[model samples]
Target: MRIAELSRTTGVSAATIKYYVRAGLLPPGERTHANQVDYGPAHARRLRLVRALIEIGGMSITDAARVLEVLDGGDLSTWQAVGKAQYALDLRRTAGPGGDPVARAAVDELLARRGWQVFEENPARATLVEVCATLRQLGHDDFVGALDEYAEAVERVAAVDVAVVARQPSVEQTVEYVIVGTVLGDTVLAALRRLAQEHLSRNAFG
Candidate 1:
């Protein structure tokens, strides 16, 4: 398809598509003529991914570009790519909410106790510690006390994800699936969490 078809089909403006191409977020389509470019399904998919990172994940162009760099060059397994995407979209990596000794120690202890080793660059570590610090600051020690339970639940979800990934027929498809899941699954999870919380809160308080 041509750029127009790609733009219309993806609901991405032609100008913005051009911008993405220039930004290296989307690859240049195959040039068919002096002024025409042909884009395939892969281009369409990548355009969607770029938009998802910017619109849904709240990632800056630079950060989205960096995440794509990992996708292209990291040679990571499906699970590893998915893991890195989670950390890449986090707002904390640039300037985290900061960590005092207590909160930092708790994060360290949580990781150690859970027997999970995450990348040193994962922004979630700092973000989690910051949340713990704020919880302690706000006298919400009980919420902070639920870290182990939360980690357990998260691990179960991770296990299910691994099972799902195992069913992918090819490594290429699996990697693409992970990227799509990483970008959009977060929104799906957050929306569901909100609805669940609302339903539970109404039952408890009303």
Candidate 2:
């Protein structure tokens, strides 16, 4: 198909498509003539993936480009693909609590107490510690106390997510499923939680 057809099929603007190609997020289409290009179904699929990373996942172009490099390389297992996506999305923020000994010990204790095996250099550890510090700063220690309970629930959800991705037939399919599930599922879960909270609030207060 031509660029106009590709644009129509994808609901993406021609200029935006060209920009993505130039940014190296998407590969250039075939050069059919001096002023014409042709795209294929693969291009269409790639465009959708690009859009999902940028629109749903909220990844910057640079991060998205890194992800595209991984996706383009292929041959990754489901675990590798999802892990690479997570790595790309990680902003590697400064350690929270600024290396407070108490916060650091608390984070270590929480992991040990939960029997969770997390890597020392994992970004999630720092993020969780930062959140704990913020909770203490805000006098919301009860929430921190309930962190274990939250982890228990999340572990169950994570197991289910793993099973869902495992059922996919191919790496590409699994990557797509994980990307959609992780990104859109967050919004869906949050919306559901708010709805449930509203219902309980009405029942308790009305």
Candidate 3:
């Protein structure tokens, strides 16, 4: 297929596809002639993934490029690539680890109690501390009290996520599934949560 066909198939513009190639987000196609390049299904898949990372995942082009680089280069295993990609997309890493000490202790306690073998430097630990601290500041003790429930719910969700990703047959497909599933899955989960809240609210308050 040509660039136009690739673009049409992926719903990305030809200009944007060219830009992605130039930006190193997508690889250059095979040169067929002096002015003709032939793109394959791999190119189409990559273009769609690029668009998903940027447009759906809310990742900047630079971040998306970094993730693609991690996936494309090195001999990392599929899970390792997925872990690195998740780290690359973790915006919380850019936030300094200066959250409340009390909240941090609580989060640490929660992790230890659950026996989760998360890395100490995981940015999400700090994010959890920050959220707990903010909730405390706002006097939302009742909401904060549900931390265990929230953790349990998310654990189940994570299980489902991994189960779905495990069905992919190839390493490339598995990594891509992780990237796309996790990024867009957050959005899907949030939307479903909102709908559930609304339904429950209506039932309870009516």
Candidate 4:
């Protein structure tokens, strides 16, 4: 297909598609003639993936490009590639090492209690610590009492995610599943949570 057709199919502007090609987020199409470039289904898929990363995932073009590179490259193991992409997708501003010690201690205890072998430098560690501290500051420290429940639910969700990704036949497909599942899945999960909360609240209050 031509660029216009690709644009129509993707709901992305032709100018933005050109920009993505130039930015290395989407690969250039085949030059069919002097002024004609032809895109295939692969191009269409990639364009959608790029838009999902940038628009839905709220990633900058640079980060999206980096993730594409990681996915396309054979240098990294599947675990490493997916981890890099997941790390890049984390948009939260981590409260660095100097965050509240009480919160850090709580996080440490949670990790220990859960037997999670996460690296100390994982950005989520700091994010969790920051959240705990903020809750405490707001006199909602009891929120952490439900951390185990949240963790258990998350573990089940993670299991489902892993099972789906594991079914992919290739490393590239696996990485794509991970990226899409993490970025878009987050929105899906949040929306479901909101609906569930409303339903439960109505049941309890009615």
Candidate 5:
């Protein structure tokens, strides 16, 4: 398809598509002439993925580019990419107004209170700790007390995930399932929790 058709199909602007092509985020289209070019389905897919990383995943261009590199290599499991994307989104969201001493101290205190053994050197860990800080700012201290329970729940979930993955024959398949499962499992568990809560409520009321 021509650039115009590519733009129309992908809902990305022609100029933006050209920029992506220049950035190597999207592959260069075949040159029909000195001024004209044609794109293929791969270009459309790449553009869509780029938009998803930026708009839905909330990743910065640099971070998105790195993720795109990982995805292009196709060596890592899908779960790894999902985890990295989640971590990136968290970092972007918790960036915290760039150096407010009071907020920084509050976040540190929250992490300390929660007994979160975070390595200061690891930005990702710091980002997670900052989420705790954000929660504190929002006046939700329930997580502080529920840390142990949450940790136990996570352990249980991890064990179940491992058992399921163990049934897969190859490492690649296991990784792919883990990646896809990481996202789907969260949704599944959340729905199940609601159902269980409803059942318990009815039983208690009965």
Candidate 6:
């Protein structure tokens, strides 16, 4: 297929496709002549993957490029990429640097006390640590006090998630659910939180 046909089929602009080709995210098409080129199914699949990473996965171009590099290099597993992408999206959405050392240390100690094994490679763990650090720097000592309750809530949520996964009949479906949940679950929780807030505000004040 020509660039125009590829663009038409993929709903991506010709110029953008060219840019992707130049960036090596999409392999360059075969040169038919000095100014003409022809693409194939590989190009189409690459384009789709790129679109998913950028649109559904909410990755910036640079991050998408990095992910493409990993996919192309064949060194990292797809599950690892999925985890990395989820972490990147969460970090982007939750804006704020790590809090002071005092707060971070407090959170770390709390986690240690709870016997929660902190995985250095897990982005979610890093995010929790950062949030705790920020809360501590803000002089919110109550945040430290809330660790027990929060841990309980986390456990409850994890159990519920596990139950949901157990209902799936196959390992593939279970893994798929986990990957999709990592991204979509945050939205579900946010919506639920808003509803809870509305209910509290309406009844508690009255």
Each candidate: what lDDT?
0.81, 0.80, 0.83, 0.84, 0.66, 0.69
Clashing pairs in 6: none
lDDT by residue (48-163, candidate 4, tens digit) is 89988778877888878877887777566778877876665655644355479988898999889989889876777878888888888899967887898899899999999989
lDDT of 2 by residue, 1-68 (tens): 99999999999999999999999988899999998899999999989988987887677888778766
Each prediction's TM-score against the native?
A: 0.85, 0.84, 0.88, 0.89, 0.56, 0.59
| Cα-lDDT of candidate 3 | 0.83
Give the better candidate number (1 or 4) by TM-score: 4
Worst 10 residues of 6 by lDDT: 70-79
Clashes of each: 0, 0, 0, 0, 1, 0
RMSD of each: 2.5, 2.5, 2.1, 2.1, 6.4, 5.2
lDDT at 167, model 1: 88
Model 1 weakest lDDT span, ten residues long = 88-97
lDDT tens digits, residues 1-206, model 6?
A: 99999999999999999898787778899999898899998799779868876776566777667655544543445455445544544444454565466656766787787788755565665666677776666888697779878787777777787688668665444444554454456557777889989999999896
Candidate 2 regions with alpha-carbon error over 4 angstroms: 91-98
Per-residue lDDT value at 118 in model 1: 83
**Error of model 4, residue 8, in angstroms:** 1.5
User: Which sections of candidate 6 miss by over 4 Å?
Assistant: 32-35, 75-99, 121-126, 137-206
Better of 2 and 4 by lDDT: 4
Residue 10 in candidate 2, Cα distance off native in Å: 2.1
Q: lDDT: which candidate is best?
A: 4
Indicate whether candidate 5 or candidate 6 has the larger lDDT: 6
Q: What TM-score would you give candidate 6 relative to the actual structure?
A: 0.59
